[model samples]
Target: MRPRYTVVASLSRLHRTFLTAPSSSDEGFDFIFYMTNKAKSINKALNDAVPLCNNPLVLKIHEAMRYTLLSGGKRVRPMLCLAACELVGGQESTAVPGACAVEMIHASSLIQDDLPCMDDDSLRRGKPTNHKVFGEDIAVLTADALIALAVKKLASSTSFGVSPERVLRAVLEMAKAVGTEGLVAGQAADLAGEGMSLEENEVGLKHLEFIHIHKTAALLEAAAVIGAIIGGGSDEEIERLRRYARCTGLMFQVVDDVLDVTKSSEELGKTAGKDLIAGKMTYPRVMGVEKSREYAEKLNREAREHLQGFDSNKVAPLLSLADYIVNRQN
Candidate 1:
């Protein structure tokens, strides 16, 4: 077992590592400054959305939820959502609720995935897993609460100046990502794929893609598409962003799989090499490290290609984000 001090990554340490600025080729774009500002905004919105209070009743559940939701990560999914919204000429404010909702859903997934019954992980985001810190029962309740609260957030989208129809579309789109079509399907497949020797499996690559596309990429795709929908993007624009998000999301996982081995737990803020130890199918295991890196690059290029024809100015954040995913050390 890891020492107690090592089990829970300090918020400050995780932030410095997780939120490092993305590299930008355009000298004109201050990616660092832009990310810092947006990170603060997203963090504040999330905090307001899930504040801990001595609710004469549900305090521990709220604590568990906040422990994961507010714990630092790159916030890539919500950032993608906001960037897609801005890419379609919408105000950042218009996408904040959707952004927060996507993040909550993402956090909910992470918490449940860390449960003893799921990934059975004890560490996440450099912190103790929800089930490790809170009891398993409370952790389960926390995940459920976050999902319900996320739905509540999207349910009130009209208050944010979004039309009811747009909100409904976004809600439905996000629902598909969380249910059988997305995270759930991917996770179930991942569990089934565990301990399978990739070399013996003729369809390893195909199975790997299936796992991540659903597990990691689906919510990201929904986040971007829903943001565009909320922002009143044209159908073509929404689809373009959807494609971009899918590619970016996949690339994010490819990089994550690679980092799982090359980086230490301290570097990643989570247990490192768990994938290898678990005999999980990962890019580095199936395609080799060099090939996995190449695939990530290909996915990044495709993600950027989907942004073609959009106003270059509007695409800046998304482009940097793709770069971030491919380039992140963690």
Candidate 2:
């Protein structure tokens, strides 16, 4: 028989070969070229602002928070927040805290979603998942703490000096985004419906809409609306921003479904095709792949169109962001 080392080497080569195998549908969004400046600016802002949570308890929570938050993501939510603020004529400094708050909440949800009871993902952003690194109990507690801290930071951040009413509004919107009405409900439904079959009927559509609108789109909508509110935007501006956010949210989920079939685990920085494995309802699984791609592009166009009322310079990032969302590979 061949030596054990040789067998191991051969298996490694096979794994690499599998990963690099070309797919027929190899089109992937060139994210580096598309969002280079926006990504860099967002990262710099997040790194600088995240370290400022100075209280020991907050700092401990921030440690767990940074474990995942700083772990490399597209920074889409925070970018939405900052873009919404800028669209309303607010400076980046004035909006950084809200951006950070949204990011924290997003990170917490990711952590919870990766727990054993949920997706049980072992990796995220190409690294060991939060539960994998810190143990499930601590990971769960950490996520809970970060959620609370996000609200606390929003309340205390003096840069915005937002009215108590607006701050409360932000909290309520965030609660709706992440509470039973939002991400949590979506997650529960996703898990509960695993391996369930849906006929082409109204019930299927209801399940699909609930999973997409609540689990994915709600937080994104909150990010845009909250950023606008914090920046003192008018009612009309808020309405427009909501429309943009909802469109982008749906677009984001469609692209995610596309990526699930087209991308690899390494490219996604997490398991690919898990949606099918989990039997979760997805656009690609519901609509055919070609139709799903077309739908995503349509929503992307609509999202960009919603921003036309704002100054071109102010809305450039948001427009580019919509394109980037539909076009992302991972």
Candidate 3:
């Protein structure tokens, strides 16, 4: 028989090969090139920001942090941030630090999201969850440390040529996104609604929207708005990007709900159908699969519409991202 290591290697190769193939949205977007180059840059930045530590005392915690932060996943939040900054006539360098900060916060959120008390998942990013690998104690610390580092990264944005006022605004904005106003609120609502009747009615739908907006959309909104701010975009530009990111964020979870049942575990890089099995409230559960898919498309259109009146060339990344969100098979 082939060695176990060889089988794992083959599976990894298959995963990458499958992901490299073009999705239906590839034709209009050139998403492969755009995602490749941008994800490359973001990955490098993330690596540089979170280097391995040699101090035996703290090395394990640091390793846990780096493991999750550097794990395989699309750098969507950072890319959205950089694209939003460029959309408003800002340089990519001006946004890279903030982009990294957003990803750190996002990575931190993922760690917390998969805890035994939360989603209770055993897999993430196609591998073991942080708590599963690092122990729950260290996993919690990893999330806390990442969030702290993210704030520290953002606080130093002025060094990257962002204005003091803008940097302050961005920090405060991200704090709101992470705290009670955003992820916390959404997670609370989600936990409360879990395994209970909160679907298929106007009230349930509204509750679901609240969960999506706060849990997912809040951080995304912060990512774009902070990017726009760092890019020196005007008030109008920031608000417009906020609306766009909100729609895109909602569409992301909507599509995730659809993919959960439609795709396999390998395809999604996580436990597929687990949400349905867990009695979790998802778009498909509340709206049905077809309606959920239709809602995702509707969100895509609205997200792109918000970018109208901007330079087409500049908005290409955001436009492509919206389409990619709706059309991505995984």
Candidate 4:
């Protein structure tokens, strides 16, 4: 793995040259180049941020936390948070706390969502689920601890240069995303919708969209908004970013739904086609795979439209991210 300082240096280089780079050539600013390096940056930052071995008194819980938190997967949410902050001209360091905070919240949600009472999955990112290894009780506590730690990190880990007001706002924003208004609301609605007849569960496009919006889009929305807040964006800029994030978030699920059918378990690094087995609502279940693909494409286009005002060079990461979210097979 690359060292942490190298990640910091890469981010610094982007900070200096990202906006000023010429837009004349397609190869001038490489999308893969940024995505690969930024993911490395996020992974290193996450490893450094989460307390894994500092205290023996809480070592058991820390082990469980590290099991899921450090497990391999694309660090999409945290990367989005950091990218959004940079897109709005914020220092990378200023956004690191918020980025890591969002990821912990995401991991916590996945742990809860995988409980026997919920999706009941046995594998995540090709490894056993948290509850599978830690037992259900420990899994619950581990998740709760992650959520609490996420909030604490956001409230206290921010650089002194960032105002207390912005930090407070970020904390409140993250809290809302994990509470009844966001992920919890989405999960509740999803659980309630299960076991309906095929026709009943297929339901309508509006209902399917609602589940994706709250369950998936809410956190993405919070990430973008919080990043903009820390970057000192104008209200107008933040709203536009919110819209962009909402579109990408839904597209992410739509693509995920499609890939569940198209890929194998080994390729996906999880139980493939689990959505169908659970009778859960998904884009393909209601709209068919082809239409789902079309819808993902449409959402991607719509997401890019919201970034029209930003410099093309600076927006390269965001634009590539929209494509990456949709095109990724796993």
Per-residue alpha-carbon lDDT of model 2 for 157-197, expressed as tens digits?
45467777776777788888989989899888777767777
**Candidate number that wins on lDDT, 1 or 4:** 1
TM-score of 2: 0.83
Candidate 2 has its poorest 10 consecutive residues by lDDT at 2-11
**Model 4: per-residue Cα lDDT over 94-173, one tens digit each:** 88778888888999999999999999999886678999998999999999999988887788745547788888888888
- Whichever of 1 and 3 has more TM-score, that candidate is 1
**lDDT string, candidate 3, 105-211, tens digits:** 99898999999999999998678899999999999999999999999888888998788999999999899999999999999988877887653443588888999
All candidates in order of TM-score, best leading: 1, 3, 4, 2
Better of 2 and 4 by lDDT: 4
In candidate 3, which residue ranges exceed 4 Å CA deviation? 1-29, 198-202
* TM-score, prediction 1: 0.92
- Estimate the overall C-alpha local distance difference test score of candidate 3: 0.84
Candidate 1 off by > 4 Å:
1-24
For model 4, state the Cα shift of residue 221 in Å: 1.1
Pull out the clashing pairs in model 1: 9-126
How high is each candidate's TM-score?
0.92, 0.83, 0.91, 0.89
Which scores higher on lDDT, 1 or 2? 1
Clash pairs (backbone) in predicted model 2: none
